[model samples]
Target chain A: MESTQATNHVSYLQHKPHKIGILNWILSTDHKRIGLLYLYSIMVFFIVAAFLGLLMRIEKFAPGETIMDAQTYNGVFTVHGIIMIFIIVIPGLAAVFGNFFLPILIGAKDVAFPKLNLFSWYIYIAGAILALISQFASGGAPDTGWTFYVPYSADSSTNVIWALTAAFILGFSSILTGLNFIVTIHRLRAPGMSWFRMPLFPWSIYATSWIQVLATPIVGITLLMVIAERTLNIGFFDPALGGDPILFQHLFWIYSHPAVYIMILPAMGVVTEIFPTFSQKPIFGYSAIALSSVAIAAVGYFVWGHHMFTTGISYWSRWFFSFLTFIVAVPSAIKVFNWISTMYGGSIDLKPPLLWAIGFIFLFMIGGLTGLVLGALATNVHVHDTTFVVAHFHYIIFGGMGFAFFAGLHYWFPKMFGKMYNIKLANISFIITFIGFNVLYFPLFIIGLQGMPRRYFDYFPEYQYGHVISTIGAFILIIGIFIMLFNFFRGARKGEIAPANPWKGVTLDWQIESPPTLLNFDEIPVITEKPYTFKKEEEA
Target chain B: MEDKKHHISSFNSLLMVLIGLFIMTGISVMITEIHFSTFSVGVALLLASIKGYLVLTYFMHLKYDEPIFRIMVFLILLLFAIVIGITFIDYLLR
Candidate 1:
């Protein structure tokens, strides 16, 4: 603390000049360090899950039990979904970049409860470890899928209890982080930084944290009930004991649907920041874009029932859910248009970060439109559990949220590490990843409509071409990811020294030193102007 | 000063909220005494909302807090109501 003692010039990378080393990271409460900690940990899980996904794709390449057995294939995708959903993507953006940039953006030193922030990371790791342990627990890995649906989960011989309990604990980690962000945003903005004047990223985070706080608990309770049913022979979801399976689904999705927003809203926030910063213009319709995050979160809850339309819900319920699902498109579409408008006629800087953000918009629009397809009662019945649904989810979760995470990572890389990555290589990686992603998922849309079902170890000869194409795309995509990560690692060590405000932006973060000091601002910045004031300064 | 005005501190207000909660609890039990099965759940929920309102207002100081806080709490409750109501639309329609 002494070495970092309120110096204006020292970046956070130089905190504790002569003190305890890794303990400063694992045990420290600094928000910047906590964000990097999440970055390192989540990336490790991302690679692991990506490999799992590749294996699943390989098995599907030529159908007919290529390598793994049906049971192993089932277990692989389940664990893959668990690791990707619970460990990596769900908490990815908010935990990593949000933790890193939020305090600096708001002109605060750290989160309101700094120690609680560190505690949540530990909880996340503990839950992740438990999920790994569940893979080897009694009766092998869980095959109930990430949704962990009804009587099967209750009666399965696989380690459903461990998986559910791990998910339940992971919910706590998410809740605490959400609670921390909400409080920090509410109570910690620096002098003169009113709500509307706050940057779009933090505004979206404010929305995400609310969903995390309110929606995560529902999944926690539902998972606990699943554990209770598995262990105690309770008939909560089992038809043998006269319980309705539909209720379990309702409870699961009530949280899971909102949990989807928790995944994407921060990603949208990252895109919001990236667009203007890259385009060298003030954000278009800033207020509408900021409020739409809240609108998406608000509308997210009412439409969970859409996921259940094919499950024999009543006719009226289906219609109600279908209408609400389409309604979510409005706010989401507004954000897409706003991002494009931000880019229009501006001094467009097509950096790696901006490219990824642009990529996110294109991919996410496809995902959202496909989602409306699946939301309708008519089309949903045609592709309910097919590879089409799988492709749709990946495009949204992997393509949308995942690319946005990469965009944030690239955008903040210099600011984060105080080093500039190889720009040429970064651009090349983005193009390949974009092409590979489209090649990987677009074929599934065709085959899925042709009715090739998902989660099977082997497929029919008819679906082989699509499977082969998707598998080849995954490899190319993985290769691009490798080069991008290599550039980041190489940049961190021996790359060009980055100056403060590399992007030449007007956010409070750019006002401070790059790789910001132990406490974010040496002198807490006064918000003299609205955020994203590009060509002109506001009257203070 | 503006925030100070938004917050409540009077012992009288707290005591009055306590009395209202007690009355709501009585009504909640008395409503069960009326014994129409369908109406019982609705009546109990209405009384409970009143009790919850008292707790949130005086006991928890939401009434004293900013309008933003009130809006947030209302939004949360409204979300839950939509979820529950829309979920039941299926079985109710069937």
Candidate 2:
């Protein structure tokens, strides 16, 4: 497979058609370049949002008005949630890794719709810029929070409209990306790469694309309704105009709950790739993991009501949602079981990527279990809107998706950049990040159970202890992230050249050059075996 | 890539589908005059679903496409129905 391809072809990085300096990247229709474009832009937004999160943590260190007023605090957290959710995590793995690797993994030269792939990035940037503008615009940042619940959002003096419009536009970007992936996966597979023969990452992307395509429009229209309620006084959610606010919650969570799956499924897919490669073994249950991705997406749709369990929805509705929420966990748990079982009998190489992959499983398990605590109707009422819910969310989003993003980045860094980051530095950074992340979020659970609410600018002195520990953890976590990123930056610039197959793994991406050429392969290879095929001879 | 044969619908087939849609629209508007109380919205939705099925099957050419596509469409409709039904659980129970 390696000997059949051209060895001297120019990498996509130095490929020449778009000769303009910056325009070479921004205007390029290449999927790999477009994937990097998403990577760079998402990194920028992640830094901004992480800074905002750090600021909020700082303010919470001391009980009363540590740095900013309550209004400013509201604005900070709102912007943080908006950027992190919309710009960073939702498109995090799929946009960056899926775009870059999905085609190569499936033995295609590029995605089915390459131009549309680039167009999605442009739309994403447009939406991201609009979100940033909402912060600096005339009326001040939106205080409605990211959810933009009605009545307050409809009547808020702040720039809620800008935020709403930004979210709506971002939803369009999501839909387009999803649409592109669906077409690409459907149409662009290599000759013999049957459905089951394709890797788990593409399978996860396929499932996530469905959620993105079908679920995003609901949020798009829901956001538009809020805009209309504000601008036209149409009263879609305003009680004064005979609208139901609970209905808004329903519409929002209908998409938003499935949106959680959108965020995590790709992360799951990333780790699925990492676990098998690092363990040097066949995946435990290929069909189960692949089908579980689809199951999570499908069942993820009906579990939105769990988020609204405390919102005065009917008892039966609450019960139904709770039951479905628990049911959704089964597929996720199946995935976790499969991951752990893959590592059980294999000769495991615990490198930086594997460490992060292991970290993802640990943290995601905590996140998933706590999610069950919240899924239970009785327990949810106890912790609803508390820091406990906040902790659960960060664990899932940051611990699950965020950690998996880092794991994928490290795993594919050599392949993507043809450079090897310092292994010691990456390992140290992961340790710091793992410790800091838990330190930052775990206390919130304790304090939340002790009766501390979330999104509040101040807290009682009793809660100050937890807040201080959590803030310290935030600083440590931020330092670790910067170090990890800096290591990658240095590696990309001046590191040892990486081999085609750094981990000696069996996958199409690994079989190709370190940094793939303009067109990924000289010829699309026909797949004749399942992904993650490990033999004893190769292990030796 | 596998070569796929494009299915082109004929003018008479398209015209018949259009006429069927128009007749359904007229019936939909006329049915508003006499409706069962709680089932009015249900009736309207059922008619709309039929029209949608017609559009998807003929106009959208699902009838001519692969069986997998039809399965996907059916699954999506099932999902849509389940979501709507669950949402109604809240409203009706309330």
Candidate 3:
């Protein structure tokens, strides 16, 4: 395997542009640097949101006003949801991993529009700052849940406008990043690396980019409508002002639901890359996995109505959405089956990345299956606003996407930083995090099923047992997260240097130096084979 | 460096498209004056979509571009139509 020193390649980290110091990172247009900028920024936001989440869990320990008052609890969860959804997970995998690796995986020098890519990160920061301002500005943090549902959002006296504007700006950033990825993938693939020959990560990014471009505008316009309603009293969603509140729901979910696919497809793509490398086998049903990403994105658009089942949408609309929801699950299940099959009968490495991938499947299955329970018209009405929905969402987003992010980070950490992390520590952190995650969320399912409503600061005494257990689980999860982060930090500073292909993978990324040089390849090599051709390696 | 020739619309062709867009806008305004009751919003959307089509075809050069661009545009329009059509299912039933 090749090493960066062996190739005399200057890593993107070492290469400095015209700008010196911090400006080199914040001002540079190199995709890798921009990706690290996103990674660092997202980590900051994730910690903030996770802390807010921990506060919420602690408050739930004994129910009524354990740590904070009702209003404060509302503000905490609202900000938590906003930070996690818009700032972290939605852009998490794609912005951080996709920007860093997409060009390398596809054998390109950089994304087609590097400057626009940097601009997206700046817009993201501006939006994030606005969100922070919303929290501490004149009025208290907007109590409107991250959904910022109608009538209440329109009437709320809090700094709702700032939050809405922040979301709108963030959505715009998402759209631009998506646009850049689409063009890069379309125009810049290596000579012989056709669509089919491209790896799953880029394919997933391609699908996610399309969703970001197409679906995000709907949310942007919808949020602006909310802003207009709040500021100008435009009567877009206020029923008293002759606006239909349900219309707001329709527009919001039109984008937000597809936005879910935008979050998960790349996660699915990340695990797909990991399974093949660790298992030392070609990905099973390569075309199926690739096409499933697009299929999920396409089908994801029409199923937004499932969210409105109890919003009193028409029966036929509910039925249509319910049916489409079930259909969307099919493509997701296909990807899962293919991943497991990829690992079947192969030389499994059982590395930390693989452990996270396997954990993703376990957690995502729970999230996905419970999603069907929520999708069914009969069952959805029962748990519409219950803690059950909360559990399901966390299992999917936090358990699924969050775990997949860790998997990709561990898998590519060496390649990205040219340093290998502590393998034993990495594995231990995954175990703690996995167990803690399940413990934190699992009880919510039980209590949610028992009729405990979500978003309330206080709950009945009967639900106390579940909340206490869940809060304990929250602490455990946080400990695991810190350990994993510390391990990465320590490894980056003082660990053994990584080989170019530590896992003996056949993908183009592994074929390059550990930390790739500026403009990636010395010369663009023509690819003439499938992306994951590990048969030769297996024979050897 | 490049082999594919860029398609530049003729001056007359561009002017004709501009006139057509203006006429459509005028019709859109005129249609609003005579309300079709429940069909009013539908009529307005139809007119707006026609204007959008003209802009995309002539101004955006989708008409002269490769088939893939046109196909992608068509698919997007179809998706938008489906979303709107599905939303109406609730209102119409209610």
Candidate 4:
């Protein structure tokens, strides 16, 4: 059945660039245009956030005597984290790539709710603008870290309420996107595309949208309480007002810890696509990998307590959280094993996307293992508030989410723009980014172990060397990212034209012509067999 | 064509959603008059859930479309209950 639609898609081949007008982009419902809108908007937000980090890094390059004062540095880092995570990275992979590709992958014309898809983009931008404006209006961005923990969050005099409200609105946008994806995947699959036969990327997205729809509201409500407490004096998390501040942490992490998966799962989806196409084989443990995506999403929700282990939570509660944390790791490990096994003895092609995929495996493993160390009650007491925790999260976010974003961009570059990115530049970019990222983040592990706390503007002189090394590494990493942007920009406008199946991928999207029609198909595809069955039907 | 047929039934669900919206707002305002501290909020929420459920079942077409969504919602609610319940347990035990 999948083959029927694949062959039937030959009739549709419309690729005239849609008017390329400002009004067309602003008001468009076409998923590709909307995706480009997201791509450009998120890139701008990332630049703003990245600049804030650079300013702070320069301040901390030495012993941090006085490039910026203490409160200013705190506010800089806070805004950096808030803008990058909330405004950019949170929606980075799924909203940009998943929105563009999922419907295409499933052989559908558009998302389930096309207008809602566009509305989500507008809401995301509105929230981002509001948060950015708060920086100027509210004396500076909130001094509270992105986590916005209570007591500090409850007591802080900065513009925390505006930031929290913006985050809540952003959560609403994410939830709507998730809901649209869920319904679209369920109802809009072309005639024969069964669950097993669908592309692995969309399957992972399917799992991710569930997390978005279900878990986002928890944070939504939590952030609202913070705003209410600040403005209305509602005391839900204020101890003085008969509320437990620690309860705020529980509520925050409940959404946040799963949010870690929210950041990484789509990356996992990208790797799932990359491994099969490059290795020239079906994914080993296809059902395991598919179900594991769902398993991570489900189990990911219960393990938030592990984040609060050192925060005066009860002993038994700590044990429960630790145990559940271990359980969540099993599915994550299963995915790793499956990817490695997929590459075992297969006719592997060493493409740029493949390099990033393999890089993700190596770095993501480091991040995941260290997470166990922190998940344990005894060890967490030592590392909970330190630079080690900061380092661990960067490895996961930078190494995990950041690497996956590049991999997906490269893997789908041809499909997205009907052109090939400079392979040489891509490989160079990956190498520099990988080395620079580790150089920047890895030392924080050592300094963090030696008792350096996170979110502090001033540090002990003993930590000066690590800080300098990290500062230098940040420059290298930024250069690598700059190379990526240049390569993609050049490729989109002037690179070699891409064929329909540039990588010889087996997914439904590649079965169609490059720069697929607005509707994606002249006829809906039907599926009769499993996806990526490269061995049984060898294609050399 | 299937697209046109699907459109007609889809409109029924949209109308049901609008009807649920009116019912929810009416129930919420009326409950303020009854005025029982926790109970009022609880009853209002219960009515809201019923409205949401009706919207889900009839409008979203969950009754016939797929079981995964219903199960997903049920699981989410179950987890919410567990988190709130366990927190309350610790409070009582202390």
lDDT minimum window of 10 residues, candidate 3 chain A: A1-10
lDDT of 2 by residue, A220-305 (tens): 99999998888888867899997889989999999999999999999999999999998988999999999999999988998899
Question: TM-scores of the first chain across all predictions?
Answer: 0.97, 0.99, 0.98, 0.96
lDDT of candidate 1 over A415-510, digit per residue (tens)? 899899999999999999998999899999999999999887877899999999999999999999999999999999999988777886768777
lDDT minimum window of 10 residues, candidate 2 chain B: B1-10
Q: State which candidate, 3 or 4, has the greater DockQ.
A: 3
Worst lDDT run of 10 residues, candidate 4 chain A, spans A4-13
Q: What's the iRMSD of model 2?
A: 0.7
Best by DockQ: 3
Clashing pairs in 4: A1-A526, A1-A527, A2-A526, A2-A527, A192-A526, A192-A527
Candidate 2 Cα errors over 4 Å, as ranges: A3-6, A538-540, B1-54
For each candidate, give the TM-score of chain B. 0.83, 0.88, 0.91, 0.64
Ranking by lDDT: 2, 3, 1, 4
